[model samples]
Target: MQFKDQLDFVRQHVKKNRMRIFTTILATTMGCAFLIVLASVAFGLQNSLKKEVLSDDTLTRIEVYNDGNKEIEPTEIKKMKNVNAVTMNTLIQTGNLEANIDAYKGSPEVILTDFKENEKANLKLSKGTYPEKADGVVVGYNVAQILLSKEDEKKLEKEKDASKINIGIQESMIGKKITLNWKNEETKKKVTRTFTIEGVGPKPKKEWEQDGTIRISKEHEEALVQDLKTLYGKKLKAEEMIYRTTAVYATDLEAVTAINKALQDEGYATYTVSQQLEEMNLLFLALKAGLIFVGTIAILIASIGIFNTMTMAVTERTREIGVMKAIGASPKLIQRLFVMESAYIGVIGTVIAVIISYIVSFAANYAIPKILYMATNEKEFLTTEIQFSAIPWQLVVIAAAISIGVAILSGWRPARKATKIDVIQALRQD
Candidate 1:
């Protein structure tokens, strides 16, 4: 048959059964829409999970401690295989400085690497030089004013009270004089000295920002902390010990396990982030798969419903099918027309579903952001934007396959029945 003849036959019948056609298309559209939405949402959830896992700073820094001992022996640690350079910094309990700042003594909060030449690596010297001359020091802003001063001047200025100096000396206050005090723990005697503050660091984080506290260079740090340790007769931790080595980064999980054995042989301890990342990654993978699995089931149900509707359509038009065959239309033409109708509905539904999903995504993405702003009571959380609009190609492909294949398959039974219909009986039926 000519293409025009075939087209006219399909269009005329479609209009005659307009009500059924519209209902079938509606169901298909809704099914497609549901699948599209499911796919997009799953993609967003996966991305959000990734952000949460990677945003942590601690994940980047491995925590190394004595495997069996409370404190690792320096010689034992040094001999361990796969060992990176060891660095020591005290990890004291959190406390408020004498000036009233809430702080973690040895945390990155109090760690400073601000000299101009520090980029060449290894905390190098800069203009006005390193803190080595006469006990001068480069310190973080928090504890800058505490050395010789009895009270914080900044605090007093803000409160307008001569006694309350609330602000810790900031980084700009470098090159100022300050007193540091310590005592030998074993001797139970006190020792104190003063020095010129050489450089300052950035303002503390919100959690770290308080009335007063500070970080000092190795020279000043030793003068203040070493004295207390010696007096107390406390040994330094291996992680807290300083060894300048050329190697970079903590060991991987597998390498660490092997190194652990090597360390045992050498009487040293091992450390790596491998164990922690492995555990976290496994959980994340399973979680992502579960979400996608649930989404796929939903899409499948929708596709199946669409297919069933198309099948019913082919059945209802059986009498019309016989008439078309009697009027010089070939059986092949009849089948083609039925299949084409299914394809038409499937295409329309897919297109409409794409548009609908995009609109829903925009509104949902915006609504959550606004709600978060109101709840957090802070501007930072509100401004932390995430890209949630991910078009899942897997979903689109699945929809296309399900819609087309189901439409054709469902029409098969009805189409074959129509072909067997006796023209005389079909026409003679009431």
Candidate 2:
């Protein structure tokens, strides 16, 4: 039979058995809808987690420490392959440095760090720009918060909110001059210098990003280190130089692992977001697999309904099949007719499922956040958005393909049985 004729024949058969077709389509619609929702939830969670974990500069940067017995020089670390830049971060509170915000006494400890001339790209700023010269300082959000005055703190307490106060402090401290007093810890002699606030950094998300730290030019960093050695009256060895943490920027993300491993091989302890990302991916992979598995159960049950419906259609059309065979219609045409009928049911069912899935996805996204907020008045629900369901175009296409394929497979045995119907016996049936 011609392709158009076969399609018409399938349509007529479906029209004649509308009840049976409706039953099969209903099962398919349920199955396909479940599959879309489950898979979408998995994708949504993965996306949300990626934002929370890999959103920082950790992907392209590595933090190395002096945890190893052998200390590494900033110069030696910079010479390593794939190392684009290296910054020595040294803590200044214990290193004969006293910090104050205008006149605020006993200022919080500040971290003294420097940026390489060629490696400014390694720093991720939130509020202001990086310091270009020695007399400029860039502070973190927490550091800015610490600089809040008693009046500011009292206002925050009175209002029972600190978010605005934090923002005020960060905004106001951007151009203020911060005084740093340097002294020989033993001799009690002090030298005071004031540095202008050049920039503000992002509020600390991870623990390491917390400490109130400031960055200066590499030239000034070296000057401070030399001065510290002089105060101690000894020529400090490269290992003996007081360093807190080192920021190592890779040329690219792919280079992070290699450079980190090389540093580890040299007896340095390294921390990078890459390791956390890998772990998170593995966990999400397993969770998605479980969700898909549960969803497939519904599809499988729907496929069985299709199988049963096709079998009954074959039994009812036995006499018609016999007539077609005797009139020179090929068994291949007979088989194709049954398969096409099943595919039509699958297509219609998938269309309905897609529509319903979209409605549910939208409802869930809009409603879940509101429900959670009602239960807990946390601002994170309002601030940090979480999508419970997100359906990507790729997933929609794949689900359509799978639904049609399953329907065709389910009709296979019934199609084969119809092709094998005996003309003589089927024609003699009452």
Candidate 3:
């Protein structure tokens, strides 16, 4: 039969049994609401998980550190089949000191990430290129201030003092002179070296871009070797200060395993990005399941409502069913109609749920973020830049399926009662 006819039939049944209709409607509404809300929360949690667990840097590189108590040898690295390009380095941290050039051996933390001990760390470029010579310096905020003349410091400081003092001495710092001294190296006599500020670099971060600091180019290694030879005046035994290593873009999971094994044999700390992603996946999966589990409880209560409505429907139509049987209605047809009534209840609930869910979802599009921020205390958590995809079409289908299933399950008892109705006995009793 067409839905219009079925709807008319539904109206007749509902008008004759107001309480049953109302109960069914309430139950169906609850079921739909539960499913829709759960879907929305699942999607939101997934997005947050993605942003936090798989930050942008995960796409670019893998980090390796020297966790071994001893040294990582170059020869051991050659044994790894999955290794692509590698940059192994050591950094020795030295404390602050006063120095002079044209009168500027500034005291920015000097990081060495070069082939030679004296070469400067490779700072991320900000305005221009890195320094050319070993002793060429780059400076962050404090170092930049110290290198500037007292009068110039006051002037430049006034010009942009609010900004971090860090600034690089890239190619622009070439030919600029500064005097360098280290308190640690001072003997009874004063020792000093005059180095041209071959370049100034912007400030550098150990693992991120720096706002105020400098970087010296790798080319400074040659100058450093010569400087060290001069300082020692003979053969020198060198020590590695820090080890820097990274993994390449592996095409498969097996490739990650291979790379990790290689780094371990070489005595380096090893890990892959996927391990973190796996944990995130497990967490989000558990959250979704938990929401579903709670929502199932609501649906179960709705099922009870469905059962009561169907049972009452059977009672109200008792005489009508007996008359139909007396008029030669087949048992199969009577059973079909009763089951159809239950399905009808499900369809009504599912449709109303969908319509109302969309209305509420649109409202939530504005409200949820504010609520989440208030709960979490993160003001930036709800930026407009986020892309919230709607509930998938599949979820809509699933919601409908659940409704129909609940209706059928709850209608089974009434269907059986209708089957047992004896026309003679029904007519004689009522």
On lDDT, the stronger of 1 and 3 is: 3
lDDT of each: 0.53, 0.78, 0.59
Instruction: Give per-residue CA lDDT, model 1, range 214-306, as digits (tens).
Output: 334444445444554554446754334332211112344345556545544654444444454567568756754565456545545555654
Task: Return the top candidate by lDDT.
Answer: 2
Task: Tell me the spans in candidate 3 whose CA falls farther than 4 Å from its real position.
Answer: 1-23, 69-84, 97-269, 354-365, 368-400
**Local lDDT at 327 for model 2:** 96
Error in Å for residue 421 of model 1: 4.3
Return the TM-score for each candidate structure.
0.62, 0.82, 0.66
Instruction: Candidate 2: list runs displaced more than 4 Å.
Output: 92-99, 103-106, 117-119, 122-135, 142-144, 153-157, 164-175, 180-194, 202-211, 216-243, 264-267
* lDDT by residue (tens digit), candidate 3, 241-358: 2224433433344677667665666567756666666777788678766776676677667878888888877787788888878988777766767777788778888888888877
Q: After superposition, how far is residue 252 of candidate 2 from its true place, in Å?
A: 2.9
Model 3 quality (TM-score): 0.66
Question: C-alpha displacement of 299 in model 3, angstroms?
Answer: 0.9
